[model samples]
Target: MVPNVVQKGEVIAIDGEWWNSDPIKVEAEAKLSGGAPNVSDAFTINGQPGGSYNCSKSGTTNFSVEQGKNYLLRIVNAAVNNHLFFKVASHNLTVVAVDASYTKPYTTDILVLSSGQTADVLLTANQAEAKYYMTASVYTTQGFYDKTNTTAILNYVGSNSSATPIGLNIPEFNDTATLVKPCEAWLRRSIQWTYGHSSSLLLQHIRCLYHRLSFTSPVEFNYTGDVPNTLWAPICGTKVKVIEYNATVQVVFQGTNIFQSDNHPMHIHGYDFYIVGEGFGNYNESDHNPFNLVYPPLRNTVGVPVNGWVAIRFKADSPEFSCSIQKFYKFVKFDDVATTLDVSKGVLAERVPVGRDIGG
Candidate 1:
């Protein structure tokens, strides 16, 4: 486990063992210089520095955190597939917000985090004596991966003399915390019934609104002709023409036969977005869609249906537009091997502004 001192805009490194087994390397790199690092590679703790692992690759290092008395823990599942449960031992972690919006703070022993979902917590480690473990492990809500990874350890001040604290036992996924589903209304109501109150009024409100909305007919189109035609033109236009910093951007991710999953956890960098709405087969135009007009979750990542489409709306508002938003754009272009093969056609080109923001 990795122990971190709460500070605003401070980057923290996480690496440890999972399920009492071998150690797995967990590293997060900052997206915007001093912010929390995005996970790039997954490595075995016992393997050599540049060895192979699942979810994350290699060369991914240093997750960042802000330096302040109270801050948010922006957790993202870099793993292509896997849900996680994050918890800190011997402390009542108060979740202040989620997906970058302020919410009523509620104390909890553990927080359930899904792939591509970010949770912000207000943690104060004021204990004078005693060591606590802050853990992020795989949840068995769906299927099983090889083993859960040890994300970090939170050591109380004065627990150890040295700057690096000793590791703690990796918690088992079989624990009750891992099995519970906090998203279900019944389960949440049960918690409120037992605790006699609710901590997340925002979540409660969102859940009510989400269920109340009636889904319209799914939008459909010919995948082979329409998608390639639509995507290729924009991609070509965006690649060659200089894009203004203030341009409004919309990215629609439509899953194909190659990627046959029902849903994909789509993540964005630099800015949070309104989900708008999503459907099973295709997006609809006509029925009463509440999410179309109402405010959805403001998040950095969202899940796109496997055979359907998920539309995301966001403004290009980052100072260093190139650094903050380039990664996501790069991933989309290189998603298929055929696109990478036509370099001579200038399908993939690099553009650099000479005197741009050097910090990015």
Candidate 2:
């Protein structure tokens, strides 16, 4: 843990959302819409749909806070298929960690969490003695989506019980500018990885895996721009790139317009990597020159920006686990196998051992 970097957690709160939907119906809808699942019937907090949702006011998730104390909220984006913008009315959040990895404290008015990502933020109870709304609203960059915002209650001790809670103003559903703040500011340390951009059918990918074959089709045009119908098809296959143990590697995840340009929450299963650099448009090799190697945000999952790219790096040292990277984007049915690190290998006579993992 970073010494003295984390704030005091006088109170702890678990923030997450639950979806009210039928599993069988949701699956059928995805198949019918080419993997697009039906919008969540309700966005809930701690299983309560909050005051704004139907007659759930009495059941809204509430946390009592004392004046001058701090509450550490462990926020998780448990939504099935949406990136969410989280914030509290009249409160600034100091982000201390993400995905269980400590990061330099960065304060902001709002936080954008892609599905499957987690954040630890400290919220100080310094506002007037009243109730306020803690909210999560959908954040996207392309196509139609559910624009609903869910809320919970942040009640100050001794506040009027019947007083109306101040509401929060979330960014617009397609607010890409607001989403860039956290992605650019998250910091820690490490080297890099670039993930290829494409979508493919799970059946075709599995077929490649079964035959021990690799298929990686690259889009040479403007990835973030208007993509033709010819480039919209899935690049089906299991593409693997092996990395040696203890090697500093860079993997860049490039966002494409094949189907739509949207934020993808890319996650590495067995490693915490440093997000050294990220930007919009196609990635240039020169982008590596400005990487924040000294204080890059170390995380297990990072949101590859809409129509942009993100570079992550880690040393292949985990000698027992084969890491796999998965993109937590809505409607994606298969994990892209872009980079596989071979770390299970033991040290040879003169060569050091290597780690194994895949990035897509």
Candidate 3:
């Protein structure tokens, strides 16, 4: 979590549905074991609801910047259960960092950020002296209770204008293909984990001994929390995923489940993972060949493509006992984890079984 001590712009973070969508509620036994997606609902920005009957744009603010100056715009996805699409009017963002790690200065008009992820971009106020709408909306896979466009305006200094800021074009709602097929090749990793001259041995060790884990959602929609024995409950737990220190780890988040297919922005706590590959349907060894060891995007939080899977690799360099507790369940497990983890660890049960059944 980035500290508030740093300078940050005024932008509303839409976490989850406001009414009853809490982190604890999403991991409830009913949702985990019973296959209920009782995540968050409509939320208010800075305590202000949306416009046009709580579904349209709301809680708009203004950030005044001088003309002809470049500013570093740091965007964060604080949503607990959703990935957001962000854009500004007539501006091409030069992305430099993601999840606090640097990238290859990729430029784009719109960027997709999942929950808990951060993108640092350089925005140049080269446009005319006017206000432009900087909008944030849900980039969803499940066509559910999506929110209206959440916006803030980029106002120019020395301009005494109360006119409405011009809004830019956001991606079409429910456009997974557009979201998945990124226009630019951001999958290349700009950073490499080499320990000086021992890089070859380090890579060898990482390739030989590695831990593979899989995470998925429930299969059937029920409320009794009595899922069949074939599935794994999305409950919170500690002391889970204990591994030896310095072990190489490869994790695959499978999205093709029997219950429902959705996009999940998986976040890691200690280190960033090199996003090796992402594709549709189940993951097969022969099918997923020529892994992007050359250059892949490394991030602490990466997403599982809707109804698909994503593969990531990283060294377990940071070792510590981390805890994963259900936000509402009062149950705190003291896991002796070699690699401390975030929320996704709990939802991940053993490796994906044969045939890639999320539950069985």
Candidate 4:
């Protein structure tokens, strides 16, 4: 949960407990403070320091809140395999931002958060209560692993007391049984264009060969099919090859029974995009047509509809470092059999044409 403070350097303590289990670990670090030391290295539960709890863990950490101002509370779900929804038990927390984007401030009783997702909240402590609880619980979304409620008590000194702050009751959430069906369908469609059966593979190989030839010779070519043309236009003609970043991206997600399912949260590194549109049951234009094509929420990641297609667009731009195009190149095979190209001609040509040129 986010906290509202007066200024920098105000000491604040956070405390909480995991419901029905061993206390969950709590670790808070200052992101701005070089290396951002783990300010909250300790753990606690239900006002008690340590005890034998079956399914939850508790902890507390102290930090200096700035004076006369607004600050961002960046929370990460380091929990191994649980989806958590967070809220301030007695306060109206304004979600001004999400995953680092400045969204319209929306007040809610609880914030539904997923594993590996981060949320920042804005809280104003204009009272003299001195202490209140920030609550986090598991969402019932599709494929959710852990099921427990956790609470973090935030204490503010010299603050007025209020019987109830604002939003307290945590709403019910279902991630798996409600959100996975659409996401799965979208994922299936996305991979088909890139890594489908025979025809798709042949097309990909042809495109890769074309790119390699363009790099060595002063030529340009374009080929299109299930693969979108706009996505490959820029690299249609290029020479110099550079390698930089490489990562293994995998999505091994599950759903409930697979029919009437829930959407899955899909994320990609390096860029953000809009959902644009989605559809279910084979993406038929006539059958499934309702979609917001105008102005959807621009997000780094999105939840694809159950049993449908999720389309996203991202600019292939990376200023920090170039990503290796080799992964795509490696997947291209000439046919059912793999053939090796003889590079002796090119290598010998490079050696003979440095300072002088031979002409008839």
Q: Global lDDT of each model?
A: 0.38, 0.68, 0.54, 0.36
lDDT of 2 by residue, 150-226 (tens): 78889999999999999877798888778876665553222133344432211111111112323343546767666
| TM-score of structure candidate 4 | 0.45
Question: Which of 1 and 4 is ahead in TM-score?
Answer: 4
After superposition of all CA atoms, the RMSD between model 3 and the true structure is 11.0
Which one is best on lDDT?
2
Put down candidate 4 lDDT per residue, 176-254, tens digits, no spaces. Answer: 3333432222233333221111111111111121122322321222211133444332333223332122221111111
Q: Model 1, range 1-360, lDDT digits (tens) per residue?
A: 123544444222222222223212221122224432233333222221211233333332322222224444555444334445566555556655565565445566666554545666566554444444455665442222445354344544445533433333444654433333332211232112111110100000011121122222123444312243342322221211222344444444544332112234455444676655543343333312333534344556554433444455565444332322221211222321111000112133453432223231
Off by over 4 Å in 3: 1-59, 181-184, 188-243, 320-360
Per-residue lDDT value at 296 in model 3? 77
Ranking by lDDT: 2, 3, 1, 4
Off by over 4 Å in 4: 1-71, 127-130, 141-144, 159-167, 173-263, 277-295, 305-311, 317-360
lDDT of candidate 3 over 80-167, digit per residue (tens): 5567787888888877788888876677788788766788877778898888877777776454646566666788887667676776
Q: Which stretches of candidate 1 lie over 4 Å from their true place?
A: 1-83, 89-119, 124-133, 139-145, 151-259, 267-271, 278-282, 286-288, 292-295, 305-309, 316-360
User: Which should have the higher TM-score, number 1 or number 2?
Assistant: 2
Q: In candidate 3, where is summed lDDT lowest over 10 consecutive residues?
A: 196-205
